[model samples]
Target: MPDHDEAVAAALDSYQYRLLPDHIHSHRADPTLAERLIDSFLQQLARYADRRDLDIHDTLAELHQQRIDRGGPDHAPEYSFRLGAQVQPRQQPAGDKAGNPLWRGFITALAATPDGQAQCTVRIPGVNQALHLTTAELEPADSLLPLPTRTAGIVIHAQEAEQTIIDIAARLKRAAGNGLATNEHALADLAQLTMRLSAWSGGQPDAIMRHLYDRIINAAHPPPQD
Candidate 1:
């Protein structure tokens, strides 16, 4: 039931978490592989936009804006992996190409080599020496932790709240159409809701939702006069 944008976002997230490392690892020797992959991905995105009747240029612009809003290319994973992030070797190091078991480790440091090539220093447990590796040579360690009960509950509640809000708006529309409510009042209410939703600046959602909840409760229960 997701809209085109939501679906596309989900697909991109999946590709990043699931397939990107493999693609990089497989073409580690080819320095131009990242550019080629990006070009191919953009072509695929254009095709998807065409099929969805979306303007490809606008979609690209929106994506670029989002990246800028998210701290720009400096924060991109390709530029620097977060320190302390768990990672495993994706490619064997030079002179250690006996196809031995790759050790999982935590990124202890990040820096560029003399030639300006970015690299990570990973600390493997029980191993005295740390491994210096490029981004293409490492992948995030597979998650082994179980989902927290509280986190799961919050997700379920949020989904239910989203559906309830949609249903309430739909019923309001139906009531307005049937003359059970004034068109002017209904339009004003809907417009206010839209404005509030649009005013959200990608901060904590609970804050805005709580404000709306207070407004609804106050409207339903007026204060007593002296």
Candidate 2:
């Protein structure tokens, strides 16, 4: 396998300039091993960019204009160089007292398979032990109950929604996995879950969890706005 750490670091460093081409260049040297690493790096970078509300086209244009204004580099660096910029990786939102989707809104999914199954793992800066949430299926029927239409007594259990969100979040993360080469499986899975979850949220009888579930699954909402 290719060096994922190196690829991700390179991708992040080149967020404004030559990510795509550098990614391509990396693979050109050895397509067999480097392709997947480059692909995954791009996916994560795009998601990171989106969360920062960074427009790749706009950012690139600005960088190009900067180069023109600066009359190109005084001298091209002998090695790969990174212009200083902050990289804000997505962070898990604060959890609810009950620990639900709204509370823990951020989740990351590590390598996903072509099948619906995904490995949802969370790693913290200081924590020695990592947390892993493995979701084998996409449907909420097994782990999460059907959302209800009303909030009369909607008891949102911390564990229930947390696990369900873990699964749903994994699918969402997978779905957003797109770059030079698309993760078609993740794309299809995300589309499938979005429609299914939207339908589930609309008709479910519980009002409380319905809204929470909707926010959890929908790509556009709870807005990734800064």
Candidate 3:
């Protein structure tokens, strides 16, 4: 009989062989595309589990519900950005090509026009009112500096650290189960951290770092009771 790890690997390989096309298999050469494919697969699996009443944790279900509550549009066969996701205009607005400063903002809402065009309501930092724009007009605001620069290198490192934390937590939960009180607290904390990280507006890195440090310190040494 195959061991648990070998069985899992064999199942995954079978699924990939059956489900993935040659074009999709080529995505393994690109880390970003591969990560996105894995996330999509997991989300689909979560939905399948929910349909079969097998979602015990309900963590992914809750995340899906939150996405819907945040005005994420449901247009089948078309991808839509969820609310509160940081994005930048793909092109500069008319008469605003001076310094070409990086304009970043969060998706406040989503809508569809009568013409069937998807739109996003974005709240830029310095802007007073939210601006409504087409989905194609915006892209994810993940890069603060040009590639190969020191700041970009740090961003890559941070991304790797975030992914490592998530991967470790996922493995620990799967190995030991989420029934323990300590595991529950850890999951809750990790969820909150995910929210905070997603909502970051790419400003005041020092302040963000300090806030995270304070959180770790407080968690380690909580306040004394009276």
Candidate 3 residues 1-226, lDDT tens each?
Answer: 4365466446555556656745555443567655666676687787788899895455464445434433423333334566666566664436336554455666778999789888888765333226888876666565222112211132222233333334435544454554544455455444543343434443343333333454444444558989
Q: Which stretches in model 2 have alpha-carbon errors above 4 Å?
A: 1-179, 203-226
Between prediction 1 and prediction 2, the one with superior TM-score is 1
Tell me the tens digit of each residue's lDDT in model 2 across 1-226: 4365566555544652344544444443555535666566667767888899887765555444434322212333221112211111222235224432311111234545566434444321112113443332111111122332221122132233333433545455545564244455544443443343333222222333344454455542344668
* lDDT against the true structure, each candidate: 0.49, 0.37, 0.51
Can you tell me which runs of candidate 1 are displaced by over 4 Å?
A: 1-79, 91-98, 144-226
The parts of candidate 3 lying over 4 Å away from their true place are: 1-77, 91-101, 143-226
Q: Which candidate has the top score in TM-score?
A: 3
Would you estimate the TM-scores of all the predictions?
Answer: 0.28, 0.17, 0.30
lDDT of 1 by residue, 151-209 (tens): 11221122233333343455554565577855564444444433333222221334434
Model 3 shows how many backbone clashes?
0
Ranking of models by lDDT = 3, 1, 2
Q: Lowest-lDDT window of 10 residues in candidate 3?
A: 143-152
Measured with C-alpha atoms, the lDDT of residue 12 in candidate 2 is 46
